[model samples]
Target chain A: TQLLEQSPQFLSIQEGENLTVYCNSSSVFSSLQWYRQEPGEGPVLLVTVVTGGEVKKLKRLTFQFGDARKDSSLHITAAQPGDTGLYLCAGAANTNAGKSTFGDGTTLTVKP
Target chain B: EPEVTQTPSHQVTQMGQEVILRCVPISNHLYFYWYRQILGQKVEFLVSFYNNEISEKSEIFDDQFSVERPDGSNFTLKIRSTKLEDSAMYFCASSDRDSPPEAFFGQGTRLTVV
Candidate 1:
């Protein structure tokens, strides 16, 4: 089974702070996706990085896929209270019907 | 902004009983998937369905779990028998492409087996 591990399981920061969360794995995947989930809701797709060393920006959030496709990172610039949520990274194998392997997730809390 | 939709936001069933979760994926999406997350745990992939059949499924999707796209738009997951451990939030998602498979998920069905 392919596993994705996320660091700093819980994070709390004041508004306007910047924080970075990471997702790592020993397996290489064809694509990696980042999602944000609110309480009692399913995860919403944030972004998908398909190429190695690729970077994508969604307003205040920046996502990057490692060169080897075994890891990814999410960075928030001047995080606001609205940015607080559970951030998850999922890796999809090239084969296996494109099923994604998810990380435990990093729960971020931005206090206003 | 199209989105997936799931019915019966929450379900409560007794152990050994059967349950069927329903989902209506985005109209144009061709790939549908089901995933579950135990409280405070990671979202685990359960099954993927395409072309009216299952394409792939995780080991967690044992014989007790089954999926069917009975109609063109409605996808359903049936658990033959429920156990306490089966309680979790079940999410239905769909995507148009496969390269990255950027999926959109529904609000989810919270299933509790008592």
Candidate 2:
């Protein structure tokens, strides 16, 4: 089974602090996606990186797919209280169906 | 903006009872999926459906679980017999043919099997 492991399961920081969450896997994937979920709600897609070494930015969040396609990372610059949520990373296989396998996720709490 | 929608935001069922979760994907989406997240755990894929048939499913999708489109607009997941461990938040998602991997998810149904 392909498994994605995320680091620093829980994080709490003052507003404006920067934080980075990492997702690593022994298996390679064709694409990777990041999502943010609010309490009691489904996850909302943040960004998708299909190419190795690819990087995408959405407002204060930056997502990077590793060069080997076996890992990815999310970095938040000057995180605000609004940025607090559970961040998840999912890897999609090369198959046409590409059912994604998700990581355990990192819960972030940014205090104002 | 178009989005997936699911009904019965929460459900409470007795163990061994059958339950069906409903979802309505985006009108133009061609790929549909069901996923579940146990409390404090990662989201796990259950099944993926395309062309009115199941394209792929995870080991978690056993004989006890089934999925059906039933109609052009509605997709459903049925649990034949619920167990205490079956309790979780079930999410329904969909994506277009243009980007079959980029899924848009619904608010989810929180199922509590007692």
Candidate 3:
């Protein structure tokens, strides 16, 4: 089983502050995805990085995939209260079949 | 954007009782999956279904847990006998292709076994 470990299990910051969450694993992955889950709801996909050293930007959120495909990071700039949620990173192993393994998750709180 | 839908957003059942959680995945999706998140814990993969059969399943998907696609649109997960440990938020997700994994998840059903 592949295990993805996310750093900064809990984070709290004032609005407009910046923060980065890290996801690391010893096993290599074909792709990595980031998700944001609000209270009482399922997770919503934020971004998916497939290539090594890849970076994608969506508004104020930036995601980066490691060169070895064993780690990923999500950075939020000028965070807003709306950005507060449980952020998760999932790593997909190269398999003919199956869903990806998810990390423990990072709970972020952006105070307005 | 089209999204997955799950029925019975919340369910409360007694121990040893049977429960069925329902989901309707996106129309174009070909692969389906089930995952559970215990409160304050990581999301765990339970099973993956494709072509009307289980393509993969985790150890957590024991004899008590089963999945079915009763119709073209509805996917369901059944727990034969509920236990206190089974209480968690169960999410149903779907993906269009298997090569590069990108799954869309439903709102999830929160189950409470008392």
Candidate 4:
């Protein structure tokens, strides 16, 4: 089974601070996605990186896919209270496989 | 933007009772999936549906769990008998053909088995 591991299970920082969360795996993925979930709600997709060494930016959030496609990272610049949530990374292999493996998730708290 | 929608945001039922969790994926989506997250745990894949049948399922999706697209837009997950361990937040997701792997998820239903 493909497994994704996330680092820094919990993080707390003052607003305007920058933080980086990492997702690593031994299995190479065709694509990787990042999601942010609020309390009591389902996760909302933040971004998806499909190619090795790919980088996508959504405002203050920057997502990078590893050169080997076995890992990814999410960086938040000038974090705000609104950025606080459970961050998740899911990895998808070939299209025919038909399923994705999710990481344990990192909970972020940005105090205003 | 279109998003998956799930019914009965919360359900509380007695053990051994049958329950159906309903989901209506985005209108243009072709791939549908069901996932569950136990409290404070990572989300786990339950099943994936495409072409009117199950395409894949995880080991956790045992004999007691079943999925069906009874109609054009509705995908349902049925649990034959509930147990205390079954309690969790269930999420439904869908993706359009243009990017089948980029899925959008619903708000989710919290099931509490008593």
* Best model number under TM-score: 1
For residue A71, what is the lDDT in candidate 4? 99
TM-score of each: 0.98, 0.97, 0.97, 0.97
Clashing pairs in 1: none
Task: Output the worst ten-in-a-row residue range by lDDT, candidate 2 chain B.
Answer: B95-104
DockQ of every candidate structure:
0.85, 0.64, 0.75, 0.62
TM-score, prediction 4: 0.97
State the lDDT of candidate 1 residue by residue for A16-76, as single tens digits: 9999999999999999999999999999999999899999999999999999999999999
Per-residue accuracy of model 3 over A18-85 as CA lDDT, tens digit each? 99999999999999999999888998999999999999999999999999999999999999999999
Interface RMSD of 4: 2.0
Worst 10 residues of 1 chain B by lDDT: B96-105
Any residue pairs clashing in model 2, and if so which?
none
Question: Candidate 4: which docking quality band?
Answer: medium
Model 1, residue B29: distance off in Å is: 0.2
lDDT of candidate 2 over A39-71, digit per residue (tens): 999889899898899999988888999999999
Candidate 3 lDDT, tens digit per residue, B1-114? 899999999999999999999999999999999999999888999999999999989999999999999999999999999999999999999999876778899999999999
> Model 4: residues >4 Å from true position, as ranges?
B98-100
True contacts kept of 4: 0.55
